[model samples]
Target: MTESTTFNFIDSARRTVKLEQEAVGLLSTHLDDNFTRACQMIIQCRGRVVVTGMGKSGHVGNKMAATLASTGTPAFFVHPGEASHGDMGMITPGDVVIALSNSGETSEVTSLLPLLKRQGTQLISMTGNKESTLAKAADSHLYAGVDQEACPLDLAPTSSTTCALVMGDALAIALLEAKGFTAEDFAFSHPGGSLGRRLLLKVENIMHSGDQIPVVSPDTSLPEALLVATSKGLGLTTVADADGKLAGIFTDGDLRRAIDQGVDIRNASIKDVMTAGCKTTSPGMLAAEALKVMEDGKINALVVQDEGRTVGVINMHDMLRAGVI
Candidate 1:
């Protein structure tokens, strides 16, 4: 390590990223008829898309398969080495196989071609070498070639692997669009995540309904409404009419304003101090949407109404507890 050859880590990192970035950018030109054919074949597949590769290509294949599965396509990864030792049983004639080989000549990957051909399984190959054996043997070949490796020796699979991953992402997104996958569909696939909770959880699921709701009749005195608000712990209480319909709401803000205006809290009814026709929401609405409604109105809670009748009440803290915030 001479002073002249200080080995600038930042310089090396920037160069590697720049090379990989260009590799990903150039992959667009390779999205030709072959890419479309591969997508069509997978779309028509009655069974899962079984991805197989060896070494570094195998790592990329694993992620590609995961992406496909999460994006409305049924897919999984199988190691090509294991495929030769009976893992090929996992694949079926109705399935489509996606094989990856950077040099397009991995022996383990190529060895399964005969068995796949015997099963009459369609093949889609992703390779850096267009003229390689694996590319020629496939039903369709997706070009993931890179001009140069980020590695100074031009040996390591750097830019080439990046391009393969980007190309696989392109394929998954295209299939997702073609299948008309919605956010709710994605939430169903990932039910345990925050995104799923935000998209799938409705206001009714986490609202305080029936006896849990803090409410009082419009003629109830302000002091009594304060007691209901405190007992329910929602910082506010709804004011209902004789017909059991929402009339208005009395919140902590109303109490503060009444004090500032020197109003009589003991004798004045909630109807005199309640804020009428305040921001309201529906129980069928998404909890995330309800959170937005609260945010838009700068209010801490919302009354859930159905046909102008109060069904439930939700607050910002409830949305937070449900992970809708």
Candidate 2:
């Protein structure tokens, strides 16, 4: 084939995007009592939501199942072909089956309808053809029909797949809102990701506590406090009173300021060189929250306290190590 430089690639791409956008926009018209009914069915399901489809629809169904499962709705995907191969036993009377078929006529998907109905399972179908067998058999049918495919030949499943994915997302989000699913709840389902680390990890969990905390007495010499800071490798040391209450904090910045002011580190007490009224965080605070405090205060470390008593210390490095940063 000869390269045609005059053929407008940008214009062709724009047309494809416009068509897909219109396809997704058309879904708003399909959002009626049926959409609400599907959400209600999934919400009331005692068993998990079972999503199934064929080919391209199957791929979209897998993603839909994942989204539902992560957002507080218990759901999983099963291919229609797999369902026919003894996987239909996974469906139950209490379960809601969401079947995706753009044409609503995929033989593999349609073949499961009789068994789903016989098992008394709730059926929700997403299809482009309302007249198709699957749509007619579904308890609640979501019209995912597009004006046309974005493909130049109008034979591909681009727009149809987008509409199905968006509809699935809408169902998942509506159910999530109705269930009052919080970010903490979502974190529990995604414990391996950064979101879980941010929501589930606490300051005390990763804090340097007890002997690991670099602490010095108010009367301790600045040089000795520096030694404690160096030994602990936290870049700072806390100066506490005889009662073990926080008096102040001396950081590398404070040491530099003291040196600039002509104070002798060997002779000066930690309290004299320390910065008073240092920022502190509670042990129960989320590590993510502690990072916010450090960010807002422009400080690298925070002394963890409990009821005005010094307990531990945490720094930016701790947040980084714990994957809370």
Candidate 3:
């Protein structure tokens, strides 16, 4: 036999994926009242959701806890082995505990049942065997049973772990939607991530305000307005009326158009070569929203207005510097 034909790696992967897909698909059909009950239990908990498991289940539990925490339900993972070693103190009576164990009879996890019961901590179990001791002890049992393992020997945990992870994700999302979780709420939990920056960062926080803004009066000469725009390095300048209200905007593009019309910059007023009623944005608007405005209008900057008065200017360069782009 050729060395390449000795083991068909692609066939092995396909079979494993097929089995795991079937396992997860079956999970949806088996969903019952217990799933809803578990979500309710988590939502109503005055304390956080405490997840616990052993071995591969423990690894999955850690991710479940993180997803729940980030999605509005405060949760944390606790290893059953560590729980026996005093980390169990992390689980309070007000907390809901979700335990994962494919066999539903993991000694480390099952041993915590009596203690959790005595403390009145609600238990939600994800196990392959609904009749196992852990499942029977749980206030809510989530059956994650799979017909067969994706492993060639059917002895290794393959389909079971995938089912557990999917179940955890399902629970997190259900609770998130049930609680009216919003993008802003999610941003608060992930302030360091790009989505957080896009949602939480405001226009006022990064806009060029005060003296940094390039401004010129409508009567100012086109040559002087160009100097102001160049000095500010923002490629644009705002033309304000005598009362300090925005009258127009002069950009590099506007200068090009004026030149195309044979309007000499040396003999023109700033107003003659400027764009009237230019786009504007509020200081409170999100930087992400401002980017969209700039993109939609094909403009590089916006005059920041609050009640008909220009306060600052936000340009595409500002968006880029702030990582909003």
Indicate the TM-score of model 1: 0.95
Off by over 4 Å in 2: 4-6
Better of 1 and 2 by TM-score: 1
In the range 19-122, model 3's lDDT, one tens digit per residue, is: 99998999998799999999889989999999999999999999999999999999999999999999999999999999999999999999999999999999
Residues 227-254, model 2: lDDT tens digits? 9999999899998898888999999999
Flag clash pairs in model 2. Answer: none
Kindly report the root-mean-square deviation of model 1 from the true structure over all alpha carbons: 1.8
Clashes of 1: 0
Report RMSD (Å) for each prediction in the order shown: 1.8, 1.8, 1.6
Query: Please, what is the TM-score per model?
Result: 0.95, 0.94, 0.95
Off by over 4 Å in 3: 1-6
lDDT for each of the candidates?
0.93, 0.93, 0.93
